[model samples]
Target: MAYDEGLAQRLREALGDLPDVVEKRMFGGLACMWRGNMLVGVMGDDLIARVGPDGMADALKQPGARVFDFTGRPMKGWVVVAGEAVGEDADLADWIDRARDYVEPMPPK
Candidate 1:
């Protein structure tokens, strides 16, 4: 499955300049990690975010956001934000931050 290159570029810009960040190819898409944990990613035309199990409710309330279930199992705390909802930089950054808030405390992988 090919990821969305356009969305990946925006994610790169949003995550650029951040410390301890790494870009890796994952799940046939682009994954950006902060401190070794996945902060955000691009799968197809969707944005994947790891906002922690506690953050899912609020994150899902955002426009074009939905629980990420790529494997047929709904993953807790993860979300898939539609590309159209994140065309604006602010929205993209917000998703990044939501993921960061959860992964920042995890021990790096």
Candidate 2:
């Protein structure tokens, strides 16, 4: 499925001033990487966040958040925040920050 362009644009704006952020296409959507590590992206209208294994459980507890199961099997450490949950800029940025907090410390891929 195609990712939401508006969401992609919002993500771009959120990360605009951040250094070492790059855009790449993945999971049929636009991925924003931090230091070459996948931080966040848009999949369909949902926000894809790599929250790390430790954060996954709590992230999923949030409203409209779920495991990012692009494939048949669910991927641990990743969560998809539904569009409704990210209608606001602050909410969207919070999700991105969760992903960034996890990926930013890792060595670049």
Pairs that collide in candidate 1 are: none
Q: What is the model-wide C-alpha lDDT for candidate 1?
A: 0.90
**Best candidate (score: TM-score):** 2
Candidate 1: where are CA atoms >4 Å away?
A: none
Backbone clash pairs in model 2 (N, Cα, C under 3 Å; residues 3+ apart or in different chains), count: 0
Candidate 2 — which pairs collide? none
Q: Please give the TM-score that candidate 2 achieves against the real structure.
A: 0.95
Full-model lDDT for every candidate: 0.90, 0.90
Cα RMSD, each candidate: 1.0, 0.9
